[model samples]
Target chain A: MSSHADVERRLGELLRTHEEQVISRWTQSADAPRDELTELYRAILRAIEEGGRDLADLRGLLAELSRSRARAGYSPAETSKAVFGLKGALYEIVVAHADDEVLRGFIRFARLIDDLGLFTFEAYAEAREKIIMDQAEQLLELSTPVVKLWEGIVAVPLIGTLDSARTQVVMEKLLETLVETGAEHAVIDITGVPAVDTQVAQHLLKTVFAARLMGAECVISGIRPQIAHTIVTLGIEFGDIVTKSSLADALAHAFRRSGVQVSGGPATRVTVRAEQA
Target chain B: MERVPILKLGDLLIVSIQVDLDDQTVLALKEDLAEVVVARGARGVIIDISAVEIVDSFTGRMLATIAEMCRMLDAHAVVVGMRPAVAITLVELGLSLGGVRTALNLEKGVALLDHVRGAVP
Candidate 1:
């Protein structure tokens, strides 16, 4: 049987003789950059030189490799293949000179490599989590956009679930836009909200009331049949808050309040109808 | 002892709070606003809090008190130009200032005052 020192010497020899083979096989399998494949090969050889003791260095190298790949949008399968290709190259060299002791030495080496594979997987998971968090933040910003529709009218188009965090963003942005544009009327469109619950209704009411306290009247539009039914079933009361079936209806109401006569198009005939106070 | 200036335009009294008000300042303003409405026989009051960054519950009470006093004098009290952060802070504080009316800015506040003035009489 070969001693630990014997296997270590063999591993060094295996790298010296078959270094290019290891790197090429890994690069072909993982489609990784040539530089990265070279570094990974060196790290694997160093691990073997240390007699497979203290895998922290190996794990650290693999971690960095995996995290960088994750950020670059590489699949986990590709990262796995890159690390495993070193094992394939090592096994091929060992089997080529197959003897009882050297083959047994490879079994121990293979087990060590398996642990390193798990390290790469962990790095991938961590990087993926960061990506998700970044996207959620971006979505929150994009979902609520406050725009000045007319001289004295601002519109906040909301398109997503109405959680407290999102509502806070909506309220702050709406109020800021109201001041920036010096708008008297604000139209809050929630047509893209998937569903409404009492909590969401309360959030809407708070936003409306907050605007009222700032001296800007708010008109909430995009009350679809489903939302309307849900509101009634939930016993949510709007209480003097103006509601409209569509944004166009809300705009017409705002124009009437501001005394901007709309004619030659729609809102002329409907302008005569009484508005609920 | 800095006081927020209260400017009078026709029968409308405009108080634009350009500073972060403290307890003493808020109390003084509450008294001063009531005095303006009663002394000037103001038809409307627009308190603009645009430049104010934070509105704690105490400051919120001052707004409510001033609005109540204006009502007693038969003057409409409209809070205008409250900063978005201030509004969120106030709402989170659970101080809705129930009786006070609000407008987005000075121009809209004046327009609203004209509307209320016409509607009331």
Candidate 2:
């Protein structure tokens, strides 16, 4: 069993590994400028020492470190190297402590700087993921979709807002589930959604796109009036997307399309008549 | 999601998740779920999402991923206390998560897994 101390040591080692990856990539990449290497290096070291500290202290520490490095008579190039180095270290630190909100805060800060290299990509991806798993579980009691059949076609009903984080999840799940279940049609009913935003709408579109990639039909149902308005106002065309007024409607569409025969009249009367006949 | 420290539960693991279901929390969910599943060979995972108002795309994606991870590790993941609004929003957002399983509340979710021995064979 690995102890907390072991985890910490692994984090340090990860920092070194990330630094090497960053430096090696930069050295080989075409049009890679050499002016900021020193600054990056210093930033990496400072970040390591203060990686998971309090936010206020973290800011102050970074500022102080920058000033001290400047006072040490290093050239602009050297300062840049230090900063990039710090970014590389921060990248590793972010991955190691990616679950920490404090580390996420630093990633946000790094986003402000344009020259963050691959670290930015890694940080944002990790930060984005951390935000979803941690925040969603805290705020909502998210239920994982269970496979259920509606009219012989598999129906995976999702009940929640489609935020960026959850959108990615739905896309992945829909694909994997479809492959696993071998269901031809999937229905996403939204009668439970309270509101919609442009970003959330985009996430929905992405899910539809992903479902198609898996060679399955994705039907979105239960779009409320407000959601409709939001979509229209946001200039989001649901043309490529199939939508129904409600879950029932979506189910009906899916069923009809799948060539399932609708039962005539009521079940009780039909059973009695059949027995008598 | 608000993440509490890992709570040991005999052979099970209970991690209380705050209701913030966003991108960052999703990453945490993946990390925590992976670690818990891999290290302890957790028999059951109880995810408390009662605080969440909405399950965004990234969040939805991460949840699916966690469920998949649990199944791979011969464990079951039970999502507890999803708000009605959150559920509705996810549907409207057109997120289709298949293969993930859920229980209405923590008690049921946990109970459902207590008698089970992992993923369906």
> What overall lDDT goes with each candidate model?
0.83, 0.60
lDDT of 2 by residue, A161-198 (tens): 56666666666666566655556578877677777777
The runs of at least 3 residues in candidate 1 whose Cα sits more than 4 Å from the true structure, single-residue gaps closed, are A1-35, A43-78, A84-116, A147-149, A264-277, B7-12, B35-43
Give the native contact fraction of candidate 1: 0.81
lDDT by residue for model 1 (A61-162), tens: 888899888778888777876777767767777878887766766777778777777778888888789889999999999988898778788888889789
Per-residue lDDT over B66-104 for candidate 2, one digit per residue giving the tens place of the 0 to 100 score: 878887887777665555445545656665556655544
> Residue B25 error for model 2, in Å?
40
TM-score of each model, paired residue for residue: 0.75, 0.34
Off by over 4 Å in 2: A1-141, A265-277, B1-121
Q: Pick the candidate with the highest lDDT.
A: 1
Q: Candidate 1 lDDT (Cα, whole model)?
A: 0.83
Residue A143, candidate 1: how far off, in angstroms? 3.7
Model 2 chain B scores worst on lDDT over the 10 consecutive residues at B112-121
